[model samples]
Target: MGWLALDEGYEISLVEGKVAVRRPEGRQLKALPKALRDHPEVDRLRRLAEWLERHEAACAAQVDTWMVSSLPVPTELLARVWPDGAWQAALRDLAVVPDDDPDEVGFLRDATPGGELKVVNLDGETVRLSPRTVTLPHPVLLPDLDDVREFAAELDITQRVEQIHRPTWAKPADLEPAATEVRDYAGGVFPTRFGLAARATGLGYRVSGGYATCKVRDSGRAVEAAVWIGEPYWDDETATGALNWHDEDGRAVRLGEVGPVAWSEGMRMAAALYAGRRIEEGGDEA
Candidate 1:
């Protein structure tokens, strides 16, 4: 049997009648007969590939939310997600704080079936999951992880993935940030709060306190927009009836004075959010 490249965490090989896991490998199985394509081995390999793709996406999405909201994830939740290889792969390498403790952080190594977790501490020590909950800390929060932070930057990792090791700014990156635009929309346009938040979130905004906001580069200056939602609670089932923007000083900026890029982005955010609202007792559905 000839070995193929790595897939997920396994090496694959074409053996006997079909391509299967030798514990790792890839897609070019042209030599196998069409009838054997449905072989158990082939099917297992195919399923693994599909699962890996989904797992990677799920990991990234969860990490993004953790970064934006700093929400604490329960350790029980991680253990639950760990049985799935995709989730295990997505979670295995990053640093996590169990119980949001600042004293120590550990890199997840494995999750035990008995609801236990194995982690490698910064000092290269193996430690079990002890906290009831875990949080993926932003890099800036760890002042001692300068090496990890520097290495991540040298690799030019995307901020979304690197957020597991990167610090987030409480304020926009630009100094003395300003409001660059004032965007408006009628309440009828957006009916679901989640849809609007999702739109701004898709555009890199953080959703919190009934506001979908983002820091945008406007004419070489970092400007921010806090698009207001009708309610702050996630369960309220309300959309942003109308939206407004505030500068770093918390002052309002008129649309006429806003920069081009910020204006377009704010409008885009409003429109996208407005379009994504869910159908509720109506003829409209998407």
Candidate 2:
């Protein structure tokens, strides 16, 4: 953005998402001058920056939701949003599979105004695809994920939304059919329940009642995976508890009844919460 002139030979502009000031000679100042600290322009720029941050976060989140659910997105819609910087950042470099040809995986590169997409295929060649719809499959659903990752690394691909490199856990084949909870990530200690709750919210999970929950759609059903983090007002040291899944009606879902996407997403939430546990001086998790 170009600099705006202020009173007494002062100029201001947004730099690195912050309001920056400069002298009339065009030398950038380390900080805003005290005299102009409360200027209207400064406040306006600050608000603009905050809104931009929220908009970018929302774009990334929506893209993540589309990938997690393997939702088919229209090419025309993608083309419409491709020009926006925030949308481009969130959608760029993601692995996109055409609905007509599920076996062909390509890294998204560009979207044309005519509803065509240019993607870099496994052969390292840019190919044009005009499919009406494409699916950004979850890492768990991608065939030969290791090869995709290797190809992405070779191409120096960096995705704003964690797609090709997202951590995934496969549902175990030997699970007890009647089990309703998984204790693999249980017993992660935090000094206070607030800390545990904070970690859950920071990781984008909802802190509801005594559980940190994530709701996802899988196999055309709504499922919620929750890991007990403790009561909201509990101030004592707390430990994470078993992770379980529930149906839309709040009934406990048996292990065998949980769909693949729900299982992987539940395990992902559990592992993320556990990873933030307090560690003792001996390098062991408390």
Candidate with top lDDT is 2
Runs of candidate 1 exceeding 4 Å displacement: 1-52, 150-161, 164-174, 177-286
Candidate 1 is scored at a TM of: 0.46
Clashing pairs in 1: 10-23, 10-24, 11-23, 11-24, 11-25, 12-24, 12-25, 139-166, 139-167, 140-167
Clashing pairs in 2: none
lDDT, candidate 1, 49-132, per-residue tens: 676566678777676556334457777787788887556655666777777466667767787767677876766678887677
- Which candidate's TM-score is highest? 2
Candidate models: Cα lDDT each: 0.59, 0.92
TM-score of 2: 0.95
What's the TM-score of every candidate structure? 0.46, 0.95
List, residue by residue over 1-286, the lDDT tens digit for candidate 2. 8999997578988887788899989899997788887888888999998998999999999999999888899999999999998999999999999987887789999999999999999999999999999999899887788998999999999999998999898899999999999999999999999999999999999998999999888877889999999878999999999999999899999999998888999999999999988888888653
